[model samples]
Target: MSDIIRRDPRAEWIARNRLHPLHAAMQPVQHSWMGPNGVIRKNVHGVGFIGPNGIKRIDRSGAQQGGAAKRTAAVEVQLPLHQVAAPAFYINVVPDMVGGRLSSHDRDLLGLARQLAGSDGAVLAVVFGEHKENAFATAGVDRLLVLDGHEFDGYSPEQRVQGLRAVDNQFNPRHWLLPDSRSGGGELGRRFAASLKERPATRVWQIKGDECIGRAGAGQEDLARPLPRLILAAVECADPVSETRHEVLPLELSTALARSLPRIEDLGAVAVDPAAIPMAEAEFIFSGGNGVKDWALFHQTAASLGATEGASRVAVDDGFMARDRQVGASGTWVTARVYVAVGISGAIQHLQGIGACDKVVAINLDPGCDMIKRADLSVIGESAAILQALIVAVEAYRNGAKRDAA
Candidate 1:
């Protein structure tokens, strides 16, 4: 008879670590939650659900078929210290869909490692489920923890909290970063923080650091900790040039910020000199689009006009322009005296942001495009070539004006 195979001691230890302790030595986490009353209340030693501002509910009064709306809110999740063993970063990977096939969600989360590996020491990334190995490899992360089980698959409100508790026991990360999405990603972070003793700041849109402080609940003092470990959600948008813009920008932002905290003006994360909503004071504006392919000509057109250079989302996404120059639905909404659309197709999304402009001129090869229909003056021809001609005409007109002024 073959000798009974003795199980390896190491294998038994590994299996044991995977299972819950036979006797529950329950230690609860303490944190705060923004209750339904719109006030910060304590939720001690419970699951964390980091929520953004606003209430989500069904609108039965609306006649429109779609009765859903996305609301924005403040970040107000907190937690206690004892509940957590170490700091953790919550990482959620969402797949992109093109022609019914799964693709990367703009490769946004690839900067996970760099973003977390700051002065705070070793940070952990906890993924929701399975993804391609290469999905994280680009972020310079070698091994990623995949939290997949019967419980994690069904991620309802109650399930998310339980799963997070289980995860907290396993791999504790110093911080949590998720996408600013409608999913329970933010909520889970809030809930998890509530279960801890120390409070974690919520939201990514407004970075709550020494420079900018967060407003805690009523009666709660502005508790300042050494850049209190954060829980955040981020989104990656379209780049004008390629599919690789979002993946690259985050890494750059994270690295730069880590080296030196970026000021509000230089980083472009916060608003700067936003135009008056109804009527902007500016008399002239020069705009460029993704079609203004060559940057040289784009800048030349703006220089000749002596107008501020504005960019479309496409241009900003490609890293050619900064977020401050972006003018679109997701970027800046400007209402200037004269708005020029150079090589712009005038997509509805772009038009909505600038429709308030007084006088609009469109220069493009295709007059059939939507931008031509909306423009007060349509210059038909290639943007670069036509702009060259217009530059001389404008220069002469300006010279005539200057002589008259004299």
Candidate 2:
């Protein structure tokens, strides 16, 4: 056998998996152990090889030493910490957190806030009610303010605006940024701006020095103007802060918010059919591919899960799905919150299409496929069997929900 060591995807995956039960046991045995002086002793010479990229990568997984178990490392880089002890000013952001988490649009808005905040200024996130987000540190939040009260809950825009007004009175942020999307940000930002009697720059996508550029005329043209204190930014405003972690310091309103009579009534959410939802707008998508042998089973599984149906380019070309249902570079570029691929091999175009997706779940027979690699979670199994199991699970969950409600 050739002496050149090869990459082990499965081993690397397991090694990186903190939740894996066998992860600790799979660690590589170093050449040197601990000394009597309570210090770690390692081979001073070297323990890894230099690759073609001219970088030294440590492969602790014993593949190089003919051992079945080893850990592979390519100099894992930790993000630098960005801190502000005493903020000179605040950059307020209201994210369109649809499912109580930071969406990609929210991250991009935070990145914009970071750029505006620069060195001395701080990014203050204004959240209303309860949220399940825990990655605000990595998402570039310097300060976090949660207006958690029953009055601010539900579709109470007046109450939310009152909370923002309170934040405005206290922090007096230099600039207020919010996502200009349908997920509450757009309306809330507009309402806040109107309440403050400030003309906010809407549909803003880029920040060029002292000016802002936004798409106008139904996104057919660009409109440039002086930067406003309040801005309703579009997606891709700026690349999200990736090279640094920030302190998410908690903050509260020093004074109680002034209550106002609500004009809009809270009637709660209404359920809609998934099939009517567009691919680009769908939060959860169940997509099928060529590997899917039973088309009926795929459709049934999608319906059981109440997910919008999608298909790979091959499936669309083969007439198994409509052209509008195709997902790829050649088709619709989806940004679904949850994208589940059933039997897709993960073509480059397909990967590019789902690049903005928050979570990807791949179910395929081939473990080494590109889709499996890109997926945050993967299930390697027969498509027909997996679909059947999924349907059963979904039914059980639905029945349980009904019983509890009853």
Q: Per-prediction RMSD in angstroms? A: 26.7, 11.0
Give every collision pair in model 2. 60-71, 61-70, 61-71, 62-70
lDDT by residue (tens digit), candidate 2, 298-404: 99999888899999999999999999999987898888989999989887678778877888999998776668867999999999998998899888999999999
Expressed as tens digits, the lDDT of each residue in 1-406 for candidate 1 is 8899977775556434413331112211225433222334332212333322122222232223322121113232322121122324433232221222222222333343234443233323345444443333333232344444433343344544555555555445445454433344556656666776556554332233332233345425443334454444333221111111112111111111112222222222343233332223344677788678678877776777667777778877888777777776677666565788887877656776674465689888875566776798999887768877878898899999999999
Clashes per candidate (backbone, < 3 Å): 37, 4
TM-score of each: 0.32, 0.81
Error of 2 at 225 (Å): 1.0
TM-score winner: 2
Instruction: Write down the lDDT that model 1 would get.
Output: 0.48
